[model samples]
Target: MTIYTVTSRSISARWSRYVGAHSYRFSATSNAAMGQPAFVIFNNRFVLGTVSSLLPATLYNVKVEVLDGDGNVLAEAQTQQLTAPDVPLNINAYSKTSSSITVNWSAIPKATGYVLKAKAGSSIIQTIVNDSSGTLTGLQPYTLYTISVQSSNAGGNSQPSPPVETRTVLAAPVIHSFSPNFKTIMVNLEPVSQAVKYSFIIIRSDAVGNKIKKTITSTNVTFTDLDPGTWYTIKAHALDANGIPGDDKIKEQVTIPCSPNDIKIQEIHSGNLTVSWSASPLSDYYTTFVKRDDGLEVMCNTSLRSCYFQSECGFIYFISVFSYNKVGQSPPGNVLNYTTAPCCPMQVKDLYVSSDTIEVKWNPARGAEMYETKAQDVSSAVFCNDTSTICTLSGLKCNTIYNITIYSYSDIRGFNYSCQKKSITTGPCSPSILTITKVNPSTINVLWQQNNRDAMYKVFAFGKAGVRSCNSSGNSCEIANLPCGATFSVSAVATTPGGKSLPSYSLPVETAPCCPNSFSVTQITQSMTNVSWTAAIGAQSYTTLLESYKGQAKCHTGETHCLLGCITCSTYYTVSLSAISETGLMSMCNYQGYSSSGCCPSAVKLYRLGSNALRVYWHATAGSVNYIVNVTSDNGNFTCSPMSGYTYCDISEIYCGDIYTVIVSPVSIDGSMVMFCPMKMYSVSCSMNSGAMVIYRGKRSLFHNKA
Candidate 1:
């Protein structure tokens, strides 16, 4: 016999008796039957079957017997225990939280209460409830939970429904910090337990309640593309795996203003600097910071785009600008630099020339640290410190005109403003007077008082030798090769810076005459002598001087010969020739000459006898050979010897008381008579003695010649 379990509520009865017997009986029984059984028959075989009430999902025991001609047991079987319901079908969990969850499932037919279980990794939680849906409390936030549901009716709990995975809602994120840029907001969220993602929301503080929302996987979120200078609120929350958000946290912030543009340095003075910039659209005010490399930093704020401040003198400053609003400050804009200029001096004065230097002076300016000076035509420039207001420029040309410019300067800025330039000409001083310092036979020494301004000098000597010039830097010069004994219009003109001066007091100078080149006894005769010599330069005339009382003679200029007449023979004399200048300056040369001895004797005497004789008388003649006399009227010649120093001689052979002619002559030692004749005389004497004409014949001769 076999027994089978039924899946559904359906029954059919069939029984078999012993093989060919008609009218047989069959019986069956069950341990889990609830009521008595009934037998029924339909065909030939006798079958006993009953409809029994059985408990669902319950195990039961059953027995069946076959009677052959009597009541006897044939077969018996029993079934194992059976289950009534499986784990609840189609289990679902909803509304998950950190520590609790809601579960739901299909209903069980006989269930009296439901048990739901939720698990994370090892922790489990369970609850019993009569309704199909129930909630579990006290669950962790942002935690994963596996949930299940069961339906029960005293048959024991059904197998737990297939596990349904669910995660609890995460705790809301707390806003830790929120920052705003010009047009963006950044929100940092506090970590939440078991959170998967964070959501950030930005809302504007305006009437329209404008808002922006963003989600990110990290703990922080950034919202971009916002308005500048706008106030907003940032809200942050954590989300679970199922995209459900937890509690939210909020933070308030405002964006920064826009940065300023086009920064510029407007004006710079000796002690101040001005700066300006373009205004920003969203800015309420502007702020500036100024600094120099070696100075302190300065900051100021203003509603306008420009600002001015006291600054260091001649300093270079770096300037930066920023825009500011009620919320925050913007980034710095473009940076710029400015420098202050130096001031100029007030006045220039005291410009003069001293020696070879040019001196200039000035009054200092308010902020001048140094001074600069330059000449208009010169390339070099002069620098002076602020301590001194005067500058001396040396090594300048004398008697020159100069244009000078002066200015004050800062140490770093060089020249700034300049005084009016001045023009001046140097005055030239007078040279010393010229004088004839020395004299020579042919040259004169000329000198003048020395002067620093002298360049050259001209000496004009007025003499027989015309004019001449001399150039010198010193005080003295020579008028050379001048005529002797010549007077000069010696005047010197010095060339100076102011041109040449008037000739220095027309000096009159004379050079001593030169001695004759030569003088000697040229020739000596009894009557005359000749002298010759060379003429001296610049000599106007020549003079022959005989110291021994010979003679005085002169030769005109350019004459070199002189003659002396009537010189005594064999005489010793000092002869000198001299050169005389037109100015009466004289130079002499000595010479010796002798006049030639006389050839004929002077003062010869002649005596005559009447018709009887004559006599010649004469003195002795030097250098004469003899003396001779002649008579006329039948008288003979008479002769005298020079050796006798004879002065007279008797005449004879002439008739008594007769007229006679006679003459006398001197003869030179060479027998050449001088041919000079003495006066002739007649020798005639008639003397009448005491006897008269009666005895005339006897006393004839005695009458004519009276002794």
Candidate 2:
């Protein structure tokens, strides 16, 4: 018997069954004789079937027989897939730039190799047998490509794979972001890969869209030195390993302006009255300049640009500068100026001219150095002969008339001009005699011969004494109020219609002291003297000073004047005195402290009646004075002075109308002695003056009012 197996259920490929039959040397005739069961395996499962003898070349239905120790039919199973003649693999179409693609199916199992189809536009081109993956070289970047694949077998050629699309790299890089006006931009490259190197090209554009390149750098870039308030654009892209680039690019359009439009100018410190306003521009600066108060102006760049003005306490000026660039200057900056100290016309000083070559000298002005001088006739026709501060007149007429004026000038800009400041005429070239004399301790007289009928005299007296002057047309003049004993040199200038006469010199004059230059009789206390004044301005000190026909001594020799003492109510006197100046210049006062006046100080007096009795009284008309009496009639002694004090006393045995003298004094130690007003008396008349003037009596009669 032989075993049988089924490899196919039917000629269909959708659902298939493969059955195997197990038999012990079984014969085909037994399959039809006994209706025997058979064991078979189909598609990894077992099934029971009836067997039949089938031809090898033709399709057959068969099964296997099974005994006790052999296989027996238990169940039935089937397969879902079946195959007939394995198809060869092929590539119908694929992405040309891709490395691998799908292989198509067709033909029978006996095929040896497959073919890959490459389509060029509308035509089929190259073919490969052993590989399904295909690669094409020298292809354009970013170009579309199509391809297909097929197999070759013993039966025939197979169908090709489905058409596929792919792309090739593009040729040149395209710029994305390059903003010149913005000064910065973000660059994003397409197809980012290590195989590709990127670069950025930034350019400044002209008005006509022409490229003005600043630099070529990396893909990410930053640019500076940009102008504000301008418009620009940016472009960017990527590059491939083959020096080829993708066509993808990006751009950004914008404007740049981080700062203000115009420039700002201001002054930091205007030092002097000249008003130094610095031409400082705030933002954009190209140049600077300053304009003068005069129509003139000075460039800040010029070495002589700075100028000075004779500015008084309060004044103002206008100024400005323009900020510029290659295109043009920005808007003209605002005009501004500082309020400077006012400009005062300088005063004329030392206006004297010399006849010897007419050399003239004077003092400098406060803020001015240059000065103009005119030595000419009253008519403007002499303009050509005029000169400046140190000028000389060659043909000046010696006897003719001329006038002069001088002016001082100053400037705030680089260049400055002079103005006429002060002037004085030259002498007539003739010598004139002059004499200075002392009029009194406080007066001085200057005498000079007249130059002409119209000439004037200008006398200047200067020395260690001080500055003094006396101007007159007469031959003789005096300067009063001068400190006595002062030595002063006098210069007399005689002038006529033409000019001044030759200056005449006079010997220094010194005042004399027959009296005091400074004197006072000020009353310190009632009837008290207190006199003081600065030692004579130029006086010699005196050791002995006389007043009231009485002499008193000052401590040192330099004492000019001082109070003598509390004097009597009578005419006193003053005397000439002397002292020394701080410079040791000695001077004397011809005057002295004034005489005492009867401004009416009260007066007092007294009389002595006899021994042991006296009377005292006062000036009943003015300031009252108390009167008291104390006497030792034997010697005419008393503690009271002037015989005037508080009380009058009576003693027994004192003779009335007796010839007894007494010293009169006051109650206080400082009270006047008999020297104040000597008065003597002796008697017993002790009592208040207003009370009574009666003789003493016994104790009982003392109460009887001395009646």
Candidate 3:
């Protein structure tokens, strides 16, 4: 075998020595920094050497001969065993999924295939590929892989490349949830990769190829300013550390519509309110807004064109409407103002009356802001207006009726009053008392006080005589020509337009009794007289009042015949007899009288007539028809009518040694005049047998002389 000595450069050249091909050619290149040359022959044998430019651990076949310049082989040698190539350079692993991994490296010279080994701690996997990049299947998700690559030939394997610690791509990000509104789309995903960022691609289904893209460092993203009532397709992916994207997922959602338009109020009533509006084409339901001027508001939802809500009486409110869907609420529609009617007022109550006044009270009516009270009479009318529910009316006529009415009104609703009529009357006062101011023997006068000026009075005089009356419009009245010693009862009354008041309490009056006109002495004697007079009418009794030289004297009697006994002769007497009525009325009658002239008896004496009798006598006067003798003392009086037709009379039944007054009166024939004898004091000292007491004393003296 021989080696070549000279070398030349050629782009296309013919071969001089050949081991297999007939037109084969060879060329060699060397590294300048290694300072090694090629194509040098030595030691008389042509040596075919391995240069450093050739691939490591590779086999080459060469042809050697002694030919001068012919393309022929005399001696030849070829290697059958191929060696492994050098280790792969710059190995990297990326783009991991839940079940697969992708590895890449710089290609090695003379390498037939590559052996890729992926290790996660104790777990390992191996694969072979004839290319610079390989993907390993059936790998764990979201796991760290210690990856290495080696070049291999038919002979053996090269040293393993520098071990590269890289994590398989985290599992593909899962789409958790998504939502689409009128202006925005929100997306949420579960992280399946160890990725620090995510990318969202939102594409409208209606607008093909129109997409909205955004990148965020979190697992959630939101795309805004999208069309309303539109459907969108969303795609989300988690990016790796090398800025490569994993498998992405898709989800679909739609947005809501805008607000409804042209809202209007249909009707407003005391209990309910109705509202209607134009329905929105993209809305699913409607919401009505009802609000009052007093800061009250309410909301209700329905799918119909009109909606009803309960309304408060006498309140003014603003109405509006809106449309909404599952996404969100919409803007409100045009607003309208509404008002309700006021309710009726309650009836009047607690009606009462006082002296010359009336009081009216009532309950408050619903939705009433003010009230008016009117009271009307036949002569006048009164009105009161205020916010209160009570009123008082004054200055009314006594015992008069008045009509009352109340009116209720409000600002929101006009005046509406439904009330019943009421009537009340004032009461009258009491009348005054009747009195008697003057009275006389035959006339009576009466007077009374008047409470009311238009009152009437009546006076009546009664008792003993009869009844008498007189009426007067004034406070005073006079009843004339009434009997004396008469009594009267009186009363008064007052009247008005309503009714007559009760009569006043009765009063009593009396007149004086009349005096007696005639008085006379009918019969008279020396010692006594019988008197008589004309009796006054209505006199209960008569008193005989006398004034004489002896003293004044008074006597009361009910009989017409009176006795004035024991009169002194030649003495003048002034006597008055007064009459008293049952009512204490009094009057008097006067008279004058003197005792009659008569001869009185002279001396009177007494003598013993017998054992049971006494003799009394006196000198009789010439005018006496017979001498009337009497024996009188503190014991009793005893008289003899004619003294036995003698000037003396004997008195019997007299006790001896007892004193007595003997009287003798001279009597007239008509029993009108009498004369009184001088009374004598006498005693019977001895009996008819006077010697009996002398013998009794002489016998005692004789017995004493003998003893």
TM-score of each: 0.32, 0.25, 0.36
Residue lDDT tens for model 1, 379-490: 4433434447788766655445567676767655666654567764343334455456665566677777765554666666776668766777787777777765456777
Tens-digit lDDT string for candidate 2 (1-707): 12223221112111122334332222122223354322232332333233333221222223222322245543323322111123233434333232233334443234455555555567445555654344554444555567555444332334445656655544334344433333443344443443256555444444433543332324445545444334445544445555554443435433332322233333343433222323322223333444546555644321122334333322344555443333223333466564442222344343344442244444444444354555566553132222233544444544444554444444432112233433344455543555556666677777666545556677777767687877776677777777555667767776665456666666666655333444654544324555555554444554334356544423345554455554544345564444654455444444544544332212323344444344444333222344344545563454443333333444334544433444333332234322343433323444334334433332233322222
Error of 1 at 472 (Å): 14
What value of lDDT does candidate 1 attain over all alpha carbons? Answer: 0.61
lDDT (CA) per prediction: 0.61, 0.43, 0.63
Question: TM-score rank, highest first?
Answer: 3, 1, 2
**Pairwise lDDT winner, candidates 1 and 3:** 3
Q: Using TM-score, give the best candidate's number.
A: 3
- Worst ten-residue run, lDDT, model 1? 691-700
Q: What does the lDDT read for residue 627 in candidate 3? A: 57
| Candidate 2: clashing residue pairs, number | 101
lDDT assessment of candidate 2:
0.43
C-alpha displacement of 560 in model 1, angstroms? Answer: 2.5
lDDT per residue as tens, model 3, 1-707: 22322111111112234333333223333332243222323222322443224445544333222332355534434222333577789887874566677889998876789989989879889999999999887788767788888777665677788998876665667786544446776778886547878888888876665678888888877777877766778888777677767667777776557767777665555477788888797778988888887799998889998899888666777987877776445655567788765444566763656445667777777667887777788978888888888887777666566777777778866665555567765544444564566655665566666655344455555555777777777766677887665566655555544345555567776666666667776435565656677777777777875567865545678876587765654445677788888766677666665434445666455556667576555565554355566666565667776533476676666666555666566554455325444555555555545222111112123211110
